[model samples]
Target chain A: MENFAALIYVISSVLFILALRGLSHPETARQGLNFGIAGMALAIFTTLLLPNVGGYFWIVIAIALGGGIGTVIANKIEMTALPQLMAAFHSLVGLSAVFVAAAAFHNPESFGIGTQDDIHLVSLIEMSIGLAIGAITFTGSLIAWGKLQGTISGKPVTFGGQHALNAALGVLLILLIIILCAGESAVIFWMIALLALSLGVLMIIPIGGADMPVIVSMLNSYSGWAAAGIGFTLHNNLLIITGALVGASGAILS
Target chain B: MSAVLIMAGGAAVSPLVFQLAIFVMAIFVGYYVVWSVTPALHTPLMAVTNAISSVIIVGAVIALGAADASGFSKFLAFLGVTLASVNIFGGFIITRRMLHMFKKKD
Candidate 1:
C-alpha cells in the first residue's frame, strides 16, 4: 500500500513538473493547466485510498462550498485586482501549513513524529521554520492583500528604526528556536510563531504601490518556502521538490 | 563534535540539504523559464501560477479526511481546501479570460 501511494505521488510529481514547463511559455500555458489538473486529480484520488483517511462527510462539504465560492470570485474579480487575489491565495497556503502543523502537533504519531526525547534537532528545526514562515506568509499576505484591495494605504509605511526592529525580531526568533531545541517547549514555540508573524506584517508594510509586482512575486517565494518547510516536517519528498519549484520560480520572476 | 553529531543524524540532515539544493536550483530554473515570458502575457502568467498554487488543496483534503481527524482539525482542513480551491478555480478561469483578451491584440 505504501509503495503504491509513493508510486502515485511520483507520477503526480512528474505531471506537476511538466505543468511547470508548460506554464513557463505562452504557447503551452493552456496545456500546462491541463497537466496541473491531472496531477491534482491523481494526487487527491490516491490520498483518498490511504488507510488514515476518514470523515469524508466534511471533506465533500468543504470542497463544494470552497469550490463554489472560488468559481464565483474567479468570474467576478477584475484584472487589476489580481495581485490582491494572488496575495489572498498565498495566505491560504500559509494558513494551510499552520493547520497541518497544528494537526501534527495534536497527533504526532500519525505523522511518524516521535516523542521529544527521540526527536532529532533537524526535525525540530524544520517544524519551527515551517511554522514561522507559514505564520509570516499568512499575515504578510493579508497586509499585502489589504494594500492591493485599497483597504489600507498603498504608500510604504516607514518610521524610525523599522529595519533595525525587523532585524532584532529575526535574531530573537533564532534564539527562540535554539531555546526550543533544549527541550519540549510550547511557550517558546508560540513566541517564535508570534514574532515571525509580526515580522511578516512589518516587512510588507514598507513597500509602496509601485513595487507590487515584486512584492507579489516575493510573497510567492515565501509561500513556496513555507510549503517546503511543511514538506520537510512531513518527510514528503514530492512536496519538497514541488515547493522548491514554486519558490524558485517565484524568486526568478521577482 | 557537533558536525559529527549532525552526521550521526545524517538521515534527517540529508533531506534538509537535499531540499535546499532543490530550492537553490529551482530559483535558477524558475528565473530562466519565467524570464522568457513576454510582458504582455504577464497577467495570464500570474493567473496561471495562482491556479497552480491550489495544489495545497490536496494536502488539505488529506488532513480533513484522515482517519480520526478531530472536529477542529477537520474545520481547519476544511478551511484550507475551500480557500485553496477558490485560488485554483478563480485563478484558472480568470487566466483563461485574460488569455482571451490577447486575441484583440493579434
Candidate 2:
C-alpha cells in the first residue's frame, strides 16, 4: 500500500512539473492550471488512502467551510485587489505551515519523527526552522496584505536602530535554536514562534509601497521554504518537491 | 577519513540525502520553467503557483488523520486544513477568472 501510494505521488509530482512547464506560454497557461488541479486532486486522494489516516468527518467539514468562503471571495474581489488577495493567500499558507509544525511537534511519533521526550535531532532542527519560518511568513504576509489594502501606510516605516534591533533578534533566535537542540522545551518553542512573528513585522515595515511587489514575492518564497522545512520533518517527498518548485518560482519572479 | 570517504561513496545513501538531491534538482527545474513564463501572465502565474503551493494541505491532512492526535493538535490541524483550502479554492478561481479576461481580449 505504501509503495502504491508512493507511485501515485510520483505521478502527481510529474504532473505538477508539467503544469509549470505548460504555464510558460500564454496558449498553454489554462492547460497548466488544469494539470495543477488534477495533481492536487490525485495527491489528496492518495493521502486519504494512507494506512495511518483516521476518520474524515471533520476534514470534510473544514474543507467545505473554507472552500465556500474562498469561492465567494474569489468571485467578488476586484482586479485591483489582486496583490492584496495574493498576500492574504500567502499568509494563510504561512499560518498553515506553523500549525502543521506545531501539530507534529505535539505528536512526533505519529509524524514518524520521534517521541516527545527524545525526538530525533534532525527532526527537531527541522521543526524549529519550520516554526520560525512559518511564523515569519505568517505575520510578514499579513503586514503586506495590510499595506496592499491601504490599511497600513504605504511609506517606508523606519525607526532608530531598526537594523540593530533586527540583528539582535536574529542572534537571539539563533541562540534559542541552539538551546532548543540541547533540550526539547515547549516554552522555548513558543518563544521562537513569538520572536519570529515580531521579526516578520519588523522586516516588512521598512519597505515602502514601491517595493511591495518584490516583498510580496519574497514572502511567497519564504512561505515555500517554510513548507519545505516542515516537509523535511514530515518526510514527505511531494511536499519537499512542491515547496522547492514554489520557492524557486517566487525567487525568479522577485 | 578514508572510512568516511568510503561511506560517502557507497550506495547506501540515507533517505534524507536522496530527498535533498531531489529538492535541489526541483529548484533548478522551477528556476528554468518560471523564467520562461511571459510577463503578461505574471499575475495568473502567481495565482496558479499560490494554488499549487497549498499542496502543504497534505501535511495538514496527515496531522488530522493521526490516531493519537490531542484536542489541541486536532484543532490546529483543522485550522491548517481550512486555511489551505481557502488558498487552493480562492487561488484557482481567481486565476481562472484572470485567464478568462485575457482570453476575451484575444
Best by DockQ: 2
Question: How much of the real interface does each model capture, measured as fnat?
Answer: 0.48, 0.68
lDDT of 2 by residue, B4-64 (tens): 4565788988878767777887788888888878988887888888888888889999899
**DockQ for all candidate structures vs. native:** 0.44, 0.73
Q: Model 1, residue B50: displacement in angstroms? A: 3.0
For this target, which candidate reaches the highest lDDT against the unseen true structure? 2
- Indicate the TM-score of model 1: 0.88
lDDT of 1 by residue, A1-254 (tens): 76798789778776877776776676787787688778877777787787777677877787778778878887887767777887887787787677666555445445566553455677778878888888898999899898888899999999999999999999999999899878757677678778988988999999996787788878877877777787777776556666776776777667
Residues A1-254, candidate 2: write the lDDT tens digits.
87998889888888888888877788898899899899999999998899988779988887898899899999999988999899999999999999999888888877888898788888889888888998999999999999889999989999999999999999999999888878888888888999999999999999998788888888888888887888888998888888888889988878
Per-residue CA lDDT of model 1 for B28-53, tens digit only, reads: 65556566666666656666655665
Q: Candidate 1 - CAPRI tier?
A: acceptable
Off by over 4 Å in 1: A115-120, B1-32
